[model samples]
Target: MMNFHIHSTWSDGLYTPEIIVREAIKKKMEKIGFADHYQTTKVSSISKKYLKMYLEDIKALRKKYGEIEIYAGIEVDFSPRTNIDELPDFEDFDFVLFEYVQDSLWDGYPLWMLLDLRKRIKPPVILAHNDLSRNFGATDIEAFLRVLEADNIGIELNTNLNYTKLGEFYYRLATPIFERVEEYNIPISIGSDMHENLELLDDVEDALSFIQEMHLEKNLKLFLKEVGERYER
Candidate 1:
């Protein structure tokens, strides 16, 4: 098994990077990626100092364990007004998990610009909760779907919290996006997005079952790829 997306003390998560990887090992997780939140919830958070410290922690864990492959990443919040370059450099991590703040997830991406952003972000890119959107107007989700379909970014189906309770950004909003994400050649990632240790295995089975029902195993090749690498040991 592989939990490509996880959290730890790297950010606001409950455990340290070492404990996170250890738990994954206990969960029989062959691969683990500690992608802490780098959100826009606060005007000033996840500072440069913190991010560097987080990355170093992951590296140290990797050195000590050297048993499981650990990917240090961030679940980045893409604010509509967010300047991509100003988002700081994430090239240090294996990839950046691109999610949006429900309030400001951009619904417009010019075809050319979308392609350019894709090119600029190497290593790997994930559009977290790509199908997930705010519950405002139907037009918002429609606009988002259009932009996502046109881009080659990967998508994440966060299973930690029930998005439905978070108002309109949950249930109804992501159904269509999930369908479309599967239709396109874009890949998908199922993440527990767990914040606590006991909550670690939060919704893997259900999330996997959902994807399986949709016959989306192939569409979620990234997780499999990560699993394969981890198990190569």
Candidate 2:
């Protein structure tokens, strides 16, 4: 199993990266990533000054623990809390997660703004825990997904409780869009958005089931291919 979205002491999480890595190994996880908050006003985050240290920290853990693939990632709040214009070209990390895109409730920036910013970013980008059904319900599905494919952006199947409604996840609610996603080259990822809980390390079981139910194995493979390329480089 793999979980690409997680938090640690570098941001608002209770445990350190090492702690999370150790627990993941104990759970026999195949892959895990440390996606701490990056320069967001909404939470404790890693700034430019400590970015190198953060990457180095994850790198050291990768060497120390070969049982699981530990990737270095950052979660960027795509809202007023972040200065998108001054954002760095995150070529150093494995992948990036952009939260709250096109969500008015969080004052998130529009999709157009993110598309403009995508040109400067180097790593693979994934939309983090977004409620697509509500956020883009009015927009044309094909056109919206086309825009994402043009930019090579992926979507995350976040199984966090906070994003659930009536015991169904946001991704499950947007089943119609995902049913059509196979036609595009867009990637798909699964994340539990783990924060303070250690037992939730493998909570992505439901997400894995959803991937099979939707036959999105190809999209999942696309994301793994991107990550593999980054590692190969």
> What is the lDDT for 223 in model 1?
46
lDDT of 1: 0.61
lDDT of each: 0.61, 0.91
Clashes of each: 0, 0
**What count of clashes does model 1 give?**
0
Candidate 2, residues 10-46: lDDT per residue as tens digits?
9998899999998998999998988999998999999
Model 1 lDDT per residue over 66-110, tens place = 767777767765654345555665667776786653444354333
RMSD of candidates 1 onward, in order: 4.5, 0.8
Give TM-scores for every candidate, taking all chains together and pairing residue i with residue i: 0.74, 0.98
Clashing pairs in 1: none
